[model samples]
Target: MTISLHRSATVLFQGDSITDVGRLVEPDSPLGNGYVRMAAERVLTALPDAGITFVNRGVAGDGVSDLRARWREDALDIQPDVVSVLIGVNDTWRRYCSGVVTSVRAYENDYRTMLAQVRDELDAQLILIEPFLVPVQDEQWAWREDLDPRIQVVRRLAEEFDAELLAADGLLNQAARAVGGAELITGDGVHPTPLGHTVLAEAWTELAGL
Candidate 1:
């Protein structure tokens, strides 16, 4: 199964700390330390002639607004053929913990605006990855109320933009149930462990149908 409409397209991953995972600042350093690297490696290995280049522009602790600010430099500049985004958890997380309130309306608006830019300016294929948090602790379980709507918004946007959707939240939830409820994966109920990253890579590969 092919993961892309174009076999040799460039794929770009964007979002917050989860996506960033300390990607090397230098151009020579291609893959990051997290799921991005794992997915890229698998793609390259499986489709050696596909010639897909993976770029991760996820900045640690970034919110949706931060992505908008750097979109030109980090995303559009690369001229990616397929762009995947996994953001919005930080928005809800900050509001839940730090009293840094970003309304759901604002989050949805910002996301739409950014996606519109990608559609009109770059003409790239979009992949909207739902932001997820496994409820390891009681407090974390409540995050779903706020985060779930945002995930729905991503689903809507993907349909509106004719982009592929990777249901990371659903995948993680299933994994948690199977693997002892998030303890086997996420370390802090937010960041994913290496095992969690492997799970994500497999999910992405399956979604891309590669």
Candidate 2:
């Protein structure tokens, strides 16, 4: 899919901690230190003359439901040309760690609602990224049961909404092979190490046609 960039474009990224990557949230530099930053850097270099505004509104530990609650302020208010959403990990993580269950139905419903809002409010293009879990440790493998369903939900939504889907699950898994299959991109199996973010950044740029 080719995402045609206009001379002056505004792009907004929304997601959880992996996306957050310790952004200051202050005015000077809010792009953070993860894939979002890497993606933005590539975009800037690719379109040096273009006036592209990049906004990162990723909050650590946020799920689909949280995104819905803050959609107005973080997303709608930005009124971006392309809105990239990478979410759903927390929905799966909370279940295993805290026994807080957010059913697949609930996950899909909330995600669909947020997409609808973006469609209606901004009429912006969508980039949907899948949530992934690489079992670097033995215990983390069990998370697949919960996370797989959510990944499918995101894929289904991407098709339904006519959005571009970044299959991060497959990309990250494939990336692990490069970094020694026994080792992981994330120490905890959730967050991405710098190497993991590089893989994601490259994949994201390719997906966005940057």
Candidate 3:
């Protein structure tokens, strides 16, 4: 689906560490070193005069609730024409690693809340990216039980909100199978490697019609 972007449109990138990729710490690299940067670079290269401005507000360990709490400062205030979000895995990760559980109901609620605000306040086009896992270890497989339901929530929300959907999980998994293993795509089940970021960036640029 084409999520149209006008010249001088502002696009905001939001999510967890996958989107973060050390953006906050690096002064010169506000877009971080992940898909957000890659996608922006690709778009600029193709459309030199598009005048598109890209912003990354993803925090390393944020969950849906965290996004909701910071929405005004990080999202609405930016007044972006389009917002692309890649969240959810951390909600599941906390359950497995830190004993904090974000129930599926809560995940959907918080996410919906943020989207509603965006719709009401900004009227911006939305692109909801699927939170994916490319299991490299045995235990990571168990995360599917928690993460898969959230993925479905993202799909449902995209349809409900008339937003574009990117099946990042499906795309990366296909790549992993094609290349023999997840090692080349993602060193860990959650974070994308350089090649994996390229996959996400290419898909995002195409999806956003950038």
What TM-score would each prediction reach against the true structure? 0.93, 0.96, 0.98
The sequence of per-residue lDDT tens digits that candidate 2 reaches over residues 38-120 is 99999999999999889999999898899899999999998999999999989999999999999999999999999999888
lDDT of 1 by residue, 1-210 (tens): 234636668899999888888675545555668898898888888888877778888998999988988988999889998888999999989988898977788888999998998999999888888888887788987888889888899999988988788888888878878887687778888788898899998878776776
lDDT of each: 0.85, 0.89, 0.94
Model 3 TM-score relative to the real fold: 0.98
Model 2 spans with C-alpha error above 4 angstroms: 25-28
Candidate 3 whole-model C-alpha lDDT, 0 to 1:
0.94
Off by over 4 Å in 1: 1-7, 24-29
How would the candidate models be sorted by lDDT, starting from the highest?
3, 2, 1
What lDDT does candidate 3 reach at residue 64? 90
Q: Give the winner by lDDT.
A: 3
Structure candidate 1, residue pairs in collision: none
Clashing residue pairs in all predictions, respectively, total 0, 0, 0
Q: Name the better of 2 and 3 by TM-score.
A: 3
